[model samples]
Every structure is written in C-alpha cells, then in structure tokens.
Target chain A: MSAVAYYLESAGIATTGISLVRENTKALRPPRFLWVTFPLGRPLGLPGDAAFQRRVVLAALALLDAPSGPVLEDYPEDVPDLPGDDVFACPVRFPPRASGRGRWGSALLEEIALLRPWYALSRERRGRTTVGVAGTLVETLAERLGALLDAPERLPGTLAELTELKRTLADLRAFHEEAVTAQPGDPPWREVRRLLWRESVLGDAMLTLRDRFDASGDPRLRAFTRVLVPRGALED
Target chain B: MVRLSDLPDYEREHLLDKNLGPLGPPAWVPPGTPLRERRVALVTTAGLHRRSDSAFDLTDASYRVLPGDLGAADLVMSHSSVNFDRSGFAEDVNLVFPIDRFRELAEDDVIGGLASNHFSFMGAGLLPEAYEASARDLARILHRDGVDTAFLTPV
Candidate 1:
C-alpha cells in the first residue's frame, strides 16, 4: 500500500492510505497514512456499520491535510465484537470421515448436498455471493479437489494448476462459510472461520490434501500448501 | 487486528519478515484541493474486479479499472490469499471498497466528488517493484481524469 502511495505521490497526485500492517507501513513510509487496527481483510473496521466506516474513511483522508513527511497516524478504536460472536455451533453436522481411501469425494459431495439448502437461502437473503471466484459449480469444485486428494501424483505443479487449486479452495471456503453463517443466527466471522478450519470435514480434507502435497516431493507444492490452513488452526 | 502483537506469532513473524524493498526518500505533496473539493478516487490492493473482468492470478501485477458507478453486487474479490477474512467483503462491499460510503460523502459534500474510474490490483506473491510500472501508468490515467487525490485501501 505504501508503495502505491509512494508511486502516486511521486507522480504529483496526493495520496493517503489505510495501513493494516503498521510495521510494514513504517518501514516504507509514504507521504501520509493512517494505520488502522482493524483485522487484515477489513481495513475500514466493521462490516455493515456505515457510520464507523465513514469515520475510518474520514480519518485516513484526514491525513491528506497533514503538513508532514511520512505521517503514520493510528486509528483510535477497534471494531467491537458482535453479539454471540464468541459462540459458534454449526447447524449442520456431518458424520466423521469414513475410514477409507477415496471417501473424501463422496463425503464432500454429501456435505455439499446437505448444505445446499442453506447456501441457497444465504444467497436469497444476502442477494449476493462470493462463491464464484473459481468460476466452477460447487459440486464440480468438490469433485476436482477430491480427485486431486485421491491422487497426489496427478498434481501438475504448474502455475495454471496451482491457480486453479487456489481459486477452487477460495470458492469452496466461501461457499461453506456462507452456508453455515446463514443458518439461524448471526455467527461472527472469526467463529465461522474456526468452524471451517478447525471443525468441518472440508477442513479435514484440506489438511489431508496438504499432507499429500508434502508427501508429493514437490517443493512448490509443499510451499503452496502452507497457506491452505491458517496458522494456529492446526494447534486449535 | 494488524498490530503484529495481536497476530499469532508465526503470522506476525511472516509479515515482519517480508522484504518491503528499498525505501526511497519520502515525497510530500500538498493537498491540491480542500477535503470538500478534492476529486478522490479509490486505488485498492484488494484484487477486486468486475465479474466480467479477468480474475487475478498469483503474480499478476496488472490492475483492473472499476467504474465508479459499478454496483456492489457486480464487484467480486479474486485475491489469492485465503489468510484474510472474506466474509466482511461478502456481506458489504463497502467494508473494503467503500464505494457506497464514498458516494454518500460526495452526496453530502464531505468530499468534492469521486473519480469516474477506480483501480484494483492483486497485492500478494510479488514485490513492490512489480507494481511500479502499473502504478505509474495508473497515475497517468488518474491525472488525466483530473483526480488530484487517491484513497488507497488494502485487503
């Protein structure tokens, strides 16, 4: 972000940015930035709160008025946790993974089938979705992912293959999260993430896939698989 | 939150260890227009592009131009990193893009106006040098459109 700011400022366009990572921002200090303490994905803090979001915007833009060199101011507040944010009990529970090879395909298909209604309801209620990034049908994505898991030797380890895998995983995660969060209560994002990575069958399958990648003897595959599960999720 | 200390040790260490490339001397440009008179445009590193646009790849330094009039439903995130939360953006595009909020500001005269076009880039898997050419090119476009101020956001 600071780099972009630097480029623009050098081009004679005034720039101010919302810095999520203060350490990095401080390292490459731009003309001006407001270091926000919000979560990584959310630079403007809360999701639906318009007033709070405006405050953040104004604060960052306010930096433009500062007569200084690389001003790095901090936003004063954190996003308040929502009600029932700490508690997450997934509405639909899948049976444990079957103790056999090639079961992930069928198990994932069944889980998707089970969650279909909720996913549909989520789309209907929210009027939008973040599940099409992979540009694949949810069932098709499950099958492809399962196919790869069933045979690690099939991994091409090519850029296109890696791109497809990443998109597939992103879309899959979005689908499950949307489906689960749409059921009954308002589950905070943190809990939904925990539910996806720590407790779900999908999570188990991903971890298994990571292990397969590790065993594939491909350094690139191993490196890429590190991002499949977040840090601390395995520990939890 | 992104306070380094608030993050898990591994994540914090990874971010801190990232090479930010060589830092050049800071360049300070005075605000050309007052807050209520500046034509502000959004330059995001959130990997947001229109649905009809090409999705971003791991090493893509190219940027997509988002029309200021584009609706929230039409915008989609193709960021390669799964480490950050997407639910916020899913629920409200304004969380990351803030187009609606910017529009409201323009309506209320909190800011002068918004640019006709905004820019989006994929921010992972590459160094800042990769973005230099594209950033300078986009700066020309912004300058051509009379955008004196750029509001940058990250995902």
Candidate 2:
C-alpha cells in the first residue's frame, strides 16, 4: 500500500494507504500513507459476506475524502464472529493441499512435533540446524506425499536426498513416540539418537544439495535452496 | 544484538551495509542530465493485485505475478502465508496500495502523472535474487517508457 502511495504521490497523485495492521504502519516511512482496523488476511471481509466487505471498502474509500494527512480509521471495532462456512474464515484455509482438505491442521501438528527436539536442543547447544531444515522437510514431505497420493515426478537427484531426510525424520519421530508410550528404559539416550539422526540427515542433505546447485549457477534454484537450508549464521 | 545467523544473507547485507555499492541510473537512460527531469514510477509489495489474478499462493516458494488493474470495485490484499499482511487494510483495500486514490489524486491535479504500468510480486521467497531480477527488468521497462524516478514500497 505504501508503494502505491509512493507511486501515486511521485506521479503527482496524493495517495494514502489504509493499513489494517498497526505494526505495518510503524514500519512505513513518511510521505506515503496511513493505517486502519482489519484482520491479517481478511482485508475485505469474510469472503462472500458482501455486507461486511462493502462496509470495509467504503471505510477505506472514506480516507480519501478526509483532509490531507495520514488518518487511522477505527471502524466500529465489531470484529465479525464469522461462522465456519464463512469463506474468509481464515485465509490459510482456502489453499489447495495434498489431501484437498484440512491438511493445514495436520501440517501444523507435524511441524510442532518436528520442532520439539530442535527447540529443546537450541536451549542446550546454540546451533541447532537452521529452521530452514524444518521447512525443507515439510516441503519435501508434501511434494513426496503429493507424488505418492497424486502423481510421481521422475525424482530429481537433489530431491532424493531430501526424501531420504524426510524418511529419517519420520522414522525418528515414530521411534520417539513409541519409546515415550512404552516407557522404555533410558529413553533420554533414544531421544538423543533421534535428534542426532534428524539433524545429521538434514545437515548432510543441505550440504550436498547446496554444492550441487551452487555449482550450476542457476540463481532461481539457488534462491529456492537458500530458503530451504540457510547457512552462514556462524560467521561474524 | 541480533545475531547474524538469525538474519538471512540478503537481510544481513541490507542491515550491515555489505551491498551498499554505488547504483547507476537505469541502463536504458541516456547519459548526462537525464536524472534531473525523469518521471517517477511506483511499484508496491502491498500485494495490490487484480481481481482476476490468482490469490497469492503461500505454499509455493516461488514468486507469483500480480494483476495489472483491479477495476473500480475490486479490492487488493495479500493472504499468502509467506506474505506478511500486517497492514489492517481491508481485503478490498485499495487505500493501502492507493491505486484508486492515485487515480483520484491525478484527477485532482495533486501529482503530475501516474505510471501507465505498475508492478506487483509476492514477497515470500526468502532470497532476493528473483526479486532483484524482477526489479531490474521492471527498471528496464520503466526506462524504456521514459520513467525518470521510481517510488518503491515493500509491504
């Protein structure tokens, strides 16, 4: 929105951005725009809920009529109590997933389980492989699961390592779960092994993938990999 | 103190002044005094999208293209998981991106002109390479159209 304001202003258009998030307003520089009250994703309103959408839209348009200056409009703080059927109930709910339904709930659970050991170890050793590992695992798992559930792509060499890492993580998670349920002897050692296995798989996969891709000079792929396995945090 | 490890490489460079090299004018611009009277163009990351373009996809780690125009009634907002839609702007929120407001401003003679083309790209990919490439391409386009200055806003 700020960009819009800047563009318009630069083009001799007096513009204002009605930001819903307050933090966004704080980050914005001057000679640009203002903020307003709306939730994160439902900027317009619950999808299909034309009434609320119209009200919000009108409120935004109202800012233009106000005298020049950044104005923060707090429309009746009546945050809608949208029902489940509400199209804009949660923006995240709308996307297509591998399962084609409620995969977000499952993904959230998996991520939490995966991060448990990483968070625990982060407290003991400051270096717990980057969060990118978790992201990579999830993406790889999703892609693989999608392939298994839908269609398979001829597996790329780089992806093979990621699939292996995902398998290793899943196995470790299953083992930890069993150990916890069974009250097995020396569970701590077992847990340590699980953590180590997870870390090693991710770390090794990342290094191999990075080396392979980096050698090719494909900036897009490199960027993708960088997000998957970020490095150089150890450097000062 | 935020650790370097806590920040991504591009972020580190942006914060630590590592990539603060000199920037010249757009490649298409002629040398000498062109910078003085250049018309400015604006591109926003506010997720200002057209009505027809697909909603920002959070799942895809790759960048997606946004629409060019969003008609009078259509709204613009980012719902992409990667997109940090912190602004409380409404879903039909044009004020934030202010495309409509810009039109009004132009009509009122507040600013001299509006760019014929504005660009928007989803901002979730962690690395800046693609964005840098897009920006360079956009700059080239703007220069080709004789845009002198550009106003950039990252949502």
Best by lDDT: 1
Put down candidate 1 lDDT per residue, A93-126, tens digits, no spaces: 8657632466777888888888889889988887
- For every candidate, give the share of true A-B contacts it also has: 0.69, 0.02
The candidates' DockQ values read 0.70, 0.06
Alpha-carbon TM-score of each model against the true structure: 0.95, 0.35
The models' CA-based lDDT, in order, is 0.82, 0.38
TM-score of chain A taken by itself, candidate 1: 0.92
Q: TM-score of B chain for each model?
A: 0.95, 0.57
How far does residue A178 in candidate 1 sit from its true spot (Å)?
A: 1.1
The digit string of per-residue lDDT tens for model 2 on A12-75 reads 3333333544443434332333343443333443433445544554454445455444444555
Give me the overall lDDT of model 1. 0.82
Which candidate achieves the best TM-score against the true structure?
1
Superposed on all Cα atoms, model 1 deviates from the true structure by an RMSD in Å of 1.8
Q: Which stretches of candidate 1 lie over 4 Å from their true place?
A: A85-87, A98-100, A183-186, B19-22
